[model samples]
Target chain A: MADTEKKKVIKPIKNFSMEEYISSGHRACQGCAEVLAVRHVLKAIGPDMIMAMATGCMEIISSPYPLTSWNIPWIHVAFENAAAVASGVESGLKALRRKGRIPNKDVTIVAMGGDGGTTDIGFQALSGMIERGHKVIYVCVDNEAYMNTGIQRSSSTPIGATTTTSPTGKLEPEGKSTWKKDMVAIAAAHGIPYTATACPTFFTDLQKKIQKAKEVNGPSYIHILSVCPTGWRVPPNKAIEYGQLAVDTGVFPLYEVENGAWKLNRKPKELKPVSDYFKGQGRYRHLDERFTQQIQDKVTERWNKLVELCSEKPEK
Target chain B: MTKPMEQISWQEIEAGGVITEPGNASCYHTGTWRSQKPKYDENACIRCWRCYVMCPDAVISPDLEKNIFVWNYDYCKGCGICAYECPAKAIVMEED
Candidate 1:
């Protein structure tokens, strides 16, 4: 029975590689969730893949003209074309393999962009690529703002947070008044092969979604709520902690939409108050008691909605 | 016969998907390109193995012909550790 349990534990992080593709010496801010997501994805995807980066924080730092910190074959494309570029690379690789030019071995094409690219500018290309049904994985490093461009609010920005454009003051309860855009449901609506939401604090879950996206034959999307320490006005080291708090508070539920089924990976055994998730960040520091409860109510409602979707009686 | 675990597959815990088998997918040219390369000094003649040691992917080589470290720029991330660690001020970081 003990051996059986050991085998069970091995399944989740099964394909996690020991290799490092996102190499050290990157210029991302201390405790940037985007960097953590990239690090984990690289370890999961391994060396058999080629990546295309967008004109976000990753592209600007990893490859600025001649300089690059990428250990794998990478192409730095325009701001909004990471997904489209990846789709092109996927088709090119398929053609090259058919003609015996490139190796026919499984070559995963992953495109990574920030929330600005993903939810705002790159959404059409991203949706088009997914609808086109190419074998690729597009990850949106949803920091909720354009961190590389001084933290401007994007559609992915949460309802109660401050950004450069959405500073907390007398008029605004929290910086951002709009509810966060649901990128996962949007991607799921595309009817793609797989869509998952992950947080960098949970390395095991992050890697699995990456592996699933790579294993599947068609387009896969993962919207990772990568925390931005600088943008969120938190200390550098608390990035991972904030990620855990987001999930624990049900502000960001950990779940996956695989094949056609939605599965909640981690249910909060005891839900933490949404205030803890809010209090640490300067963005939501302006929220009063009533606004805090309002945010909590919204989170609870969203969490219940997720539970309902994941509650499909598991096909008898 | 043993059956797969019944609890929602921990595979879902990570989205654990398997592709290249362990050990087989190990880097092919690892510790190879760095096997030997030429190291040039704009200043001194000290030869330390910092470049030889700090390579995480381990793809550096000592060029026996040029008697210095020649970088395998194809695989290098331009980390510049070698340039910083060169005791002799020998290794220079150049754009490729």
Candidate 2:
């Protein structure tokens, strides 16, 4: 036994709670990083909380006709009203505490939505929630399209990515003509206390942001880039690797905004070319050299702007 | 195990369609969907916990007492993420 123990070397691991808020047996696709992000987020939030989830892939996969994978209090609302429902839930909890019906304790309220539910349908409600200064954490799990609805394109879909609605046909070489919506910028525009972008490939960073969001007094928003193997047409095993590539390529720079101050999480010495990231996925398979160059130019421009923002100190 | 979907009746439905039991979906085994399964080599494992942390199905659990990881194949959809992410290459995806 001693010799066997010596043979196996275990590396030191960061402290992560083993308690699972999202259980197994979920019907999510084999390599669904969206659910993985949810698991890590919930773990960071701990058990004392309520989740208001919009109708999307996560909602459908976790809950079927008569069963659910959620271990904590979770409510499913309409696609456009997850933020609205979350604010309502927060108010109700406050009311109960004031009335002494429930013990006065901090119960974190979190609202979750997909790219389509958040950037398109639920944009107004999200804006209202942030503007109202509700003590809620709104998370947008972006898989780049309306994945639950047969891979339809949404405003959050990246340029040159093919979706059911944004097809690369004889007339249109590029799939989506427009760039992906900058959701973190929109959330920061509301002057929320905290806003950050995270990916499941960096679990520790994702959890750290969630912890920060939970501790903040006012509204906070976290936009997570969930790599979808099914929609993106990548092998299941490559989901996490693709997420890492996304960050390395500077296509999605992981950064945070706190009280109008910007801070970048991971800054690579030199960004990998956009082609290195795009070539692995089937969505960008039809991209010609010109389109890839266009994407590279846009990504570099955005990354430079983010670097500039992070370097500047917030004016008092 | 949960009752089959065909056998469940309207009378058994919970109020407001709320599932009374949390995490009751565990009864529905998803292992059937997997065409391949992971074979773990305990001796080769370094126990870095990478596979445990990245498993989407929550089927990988670290046995703290033994200081090793265990896989619950019942619910593992066998996406091969664990095998692919393993730094030591201790896990291999094999035909189910």
Candidate 3:
């Protein structure tokens, strides 16, 4: 019975690689979850991958002229063409293999970008890649703003968050007027073979999803919610804590869509209030009770909609 | 061995400024950024690897021989994520 019980209990993280793909000493901020997410993703994919990264936080931090943190083949592409470049690389690799120039082995092609690059700047290229059925994994390391350029607001920035461009004022107490763009939903709508929402706090889940995405033959999209301590106005130590709170509060539910089928990876029995999530973050400090309630209601409504969608057969 | 960033000239840089070396940023020390640093207490540690996974800078490594994790201060920015996430309270933050 003791042996059986021991076998039943499974650890969340186990047998992880000690090899660092995106090695230490890069210039990411203290407790930056975006870099951590990329690190874990690279570890999951191993060295057999080619990364086409857009101009964003990860690009800026990892590659600064004479040095790079990446241990794999990586290319720095323009802001709006990471996906396009990834597709091209995938095609090039295929041709190279066909011509016997390179060995016949799968080299997973990945395109990485920040929230601004994904939801705003590179949306067209991403859509085109997905539409053309390229076998590339597009990972959006979203800290929810243009953090590389001094924390300006992006489409992925949530409502009531005060960014540099969307500052709180006497006229507008709530920072951003618009809702955060649903990029995962948009990717799922494209009918990609795989699309998932991941967080660095859940490393095992994130790694599992990445491995799953690699196995799929068509396009895959993974939207990773990277907690930005500098921009979020939280203590650097509270980065992972905020990531946990975001999931517990249902502000950012973790889920995946595979071949038009929706699956919720994490489902809280009762979501903690949105105010609990906003209390420490500096970005949401200006939000009053009225705005807080509005956000809470919106979160609950969306959470319920997501649950319903996950339970039923999604329209193909 | 690569020269310091300032010492290297533009002509020495590869065509298109490609960095042939992988993970060469390990040369740059980021430990100077830390205002507070983490001190590990071996007796109280559980060896759960929470600190290993949570480290943003990837400075923590497992010392299997000693059955404990080690921190490489060369790149640790000292965000205290490991200290904060430690359930056993094995890691404490101290003034740098």
Q: What is the DockQ of each candidate?
A: 0.02, 0.71, 0.59
Error of 2 at A288 (Å): 1.0
Instruction: Please list the Cα RMSD from the true structure of every candidate, rounded to 1 decimal place.
Output: 15.4, 1.6, 3.0
Worst 10 residues of 2 chain A by lDDT: A6-15
lDDT of 3 at A237: 92
Q: Once model 3 is optimally superposed onto the true structure by TM-score, how far is the C-alpha of residue A193 displaced, in angstroms?
A: 1.0
lDDT of 2 by residue, A206-293 (tens): 9999999999999999999999999999999999999999999999999999999999999999999999999879999999999999
Candidate 1 off by > 4 Å: A1-15, A314-316, B1-96
Kindly report which residue pairs in candidate 2 clash with one another.
none
How big an interface RMSD has model 2? Answer: 1.9
lDDT of 1 by residue, B45-95 (tens): 433444544343333555545445556654444434455545667766554
Best by DockQ: 2
